[model samples]
Target: MRSPVEPKSAGAWRSQIPTGKALVPYLLLAPFGCLFAVFIVAPLVYAFYISLFRDTLVGGRQFAGAANYLRVMSDDKFWAGLGNLFLFGIVQVPVMLGLATLLALVLDRGQLYGEALFRLGLFLPYAVPGVIAALIWGYVYGPVFGPFAQLAEAIDVPAPELLSREAMLFSIANIVTWEFLGYYMIIFYAALKAIPPHLLEAALLDGASRWQFVRYIQLPLLRPMILLAIVFSINGTLQLFNEPYLMRVHAPTVIDSSYTPNLYAYSLTTANQQYNYAAAISFVLGAVIACASYLFILVSGRRRRR
Candidate 1:
């Protein structure tokens, strides 16, 4: 039989320990909290405040209420940038996710040879900085000097102009695919690793083929990770800027200042000096991203429940 005094002694010890348990958490969180306040929260508040006014270089600032938001509704460039993002989300996200899942499955199979090497090779590109990746790919797409063009000319085959306006978006998508596929593959691979070994053994005992196991068991279990990857990809596509910006510098005629929402906002602030309009656009973009993220969560939750 347990002594009655044992429980009370344990409770007394717990009570004797400093009441500063919460202090540890606050101390650990202080740096990130301060950074969030300075970088994210402050900027967000400033953007909101700026959005409510119209800045004048010559005259004084004037309160515009929701006029800036209303202006966004009619902005042709804003719609175009959104349309471009929509196209990218539709095309790029599925392809990248699919490829990542396939690679993860292949690598997860124990019988595969050189799995580590293959995994490392696939993930290596993601380690390269985005700006550097863009620059390298941009040079590869260069007409007179790029390796592709040189190869095509060597074989007396016509090289398509990859930097043409019609092909530039696809060109950018290709770069993103190359850079991120490996990184996302690692994510899917980790998810695959988390599945209980007993679950796989049960499926095998039930006479499930590899295809059946993957289709019914593996994919269903991976749904949450897939949903997360899709959300990340959508956000990334909407925030596309660096690749196009670098490509524009390399191939001046291809990407314009209004190539994407970020670039458009940058031009408004830097070139046009319309900081208020830029702030408004920034808020609208953030709101769009938030709404999309919420819709993704809601839809995914419904599917999960079903």
Candidate 2:
């Protein structure tokens, strides 16, 4: 049993501590909290406020309540932008994640020569800025001066019309896939490395084939990271902007003001100065992303339970 003096001493020590000292940890975090409140929280709140109004040159400005959201629901251009995102996400995400997983698996196997150098090389492309990657790939896809065109000319074949409407979305997808593949690869690779080696060794001892081990062991362990990648990809695809924005110059006809929801909102805010409507569009996009994230979490939870 503890002595009464010890308990009293502990209580006295705690009581002796200054009340202000209790706030030291929060005080340390104050700068970041202030910045986040000012930048992130303030903007979101302001945007929501703006979204509740109607802005027009003739009508000036008026409180519209949910009118902007109603307008967005019936907006054809808005749905078209969403359709583009849905198509892009549906096709591009799986391909990029699949390639990333394959590379991570290969690197994790430890059989490849110069594994560190190979891994570094695989990840280096992700270091390139999105704008720069778009420009580089745009140049490569250019119908006239691009090497691909020259190669086609030399072979007496037609240069691929990569900037055409039929292929523009896919061309943009290629750029996106190229830009992010290394990022997801590095993520999956880290997850793979974090997996305990003892489990793998036991599987090997049990005469598990490579496919059997990966299918039964690695895939299960990888589910969490895979879900994370899916969520990130979902957000990225729905908010697609940079690649398409940059590609607009090279493929102006195909890439227009309403190319993606972000671009559409941007055009409305800047070009048409429809700030309220643009805010509504932005909020809608955010809501869609939130719902998508929720569904993914729900499905993942169900799958894990099973």
Candidate 3:
């Protein structure tokens, strides 16, 4: 009381304390918020900051605002990698998702004899790490020692050049499909399992055949999951790197430095030591992923509205 500062009243002090459900949300979210700020936001800002400067022999590190981004815009290798991803997504995504859906339907029928074994077998490849999976497939696709090649020799037929330029696209697609098909299948299978028992009974009461039940009831319900799977597939396709990166050892001619956008960015940083440019390329890729995902969502939304 004698000092310049006055003591706060009890009500005023109580009012300052957080209480009830309002604070609960923030308390729960605080961990994730802290992690996002430290990990995600910090790196992105730092990378962007790094991307603004260019290293030069004459001037040393100097501000070259937007120069790296401009170079990325005209970069043929980046464009080629993007194109390759597009083509890969176009063919592989549909095939993979389609197979997953079919497998889910078959397994959900409850008629398969060894259902658990079947499911586990399908999902086993996905359990294998991507690098190991790529290496395993690389050996399978090897020209000389691979089973396919050896079989062809035994039969006096020409061995399939799986790692060759013409076949490399499908070859890599095959590995991706094999690895992730089970994962997507499990997702669809779980979705199928989650369908209400009442709906199945109602459909049965209505004299709906298996095919009719699937087409009308199951497919309609699964549309959302299918869209989700497609979006995930697109994202994975854009971020393609591992298979091609490892396959380089087997097919150096086909799997070049700029095989996919991720691979290209990695090569830029490691091989060319173009850290700033690589950062720009990574940001560019992030932008592409965001745009592609948004466009697909928009299209799906419109289609659903119809």
Q: Estimate each model's TM-score.
A: 0.89, 0.92, 0.91
Query: How many backbone overlaps does candidate 2 show?
Result: 0
Off by over 4 Å in 3: 1-32
- Tens digits of per-residue lDDT, candidate 2, 1-306, equal 124443455556655544687879978999999999999999999999999998776987889999999999999999999999999999999999999999999999989889989889888878999889999999999998999999999999999998889898899999999988988998999999999999889999999998999999998899889988999999999999998998899888898899999999999989999999999999999999999988988898898899
Clashing pairs in 1: none
Which is the better candidate, 2 or 3, if ranked by lDDT?
A: 3
Total backbone collisions for each predicted model: 0, 0, 0
lDDT of 3 by residue, 45-110 (tens): 999999999988799889999999999999999999999999999999999999999999999888
**Residue-by-residue lDDT tens digits, candidate 1, 14-125:** 5554457756977889999999999999999998998999977687899999999999989999989898888877988999999999999988876788888999999999
List the RMSD of every prediction in angstroms.
7.2, 6.7, 7.8
Name the candidate that leads on TM-score.
2
For model 2, which pairs clash?
none
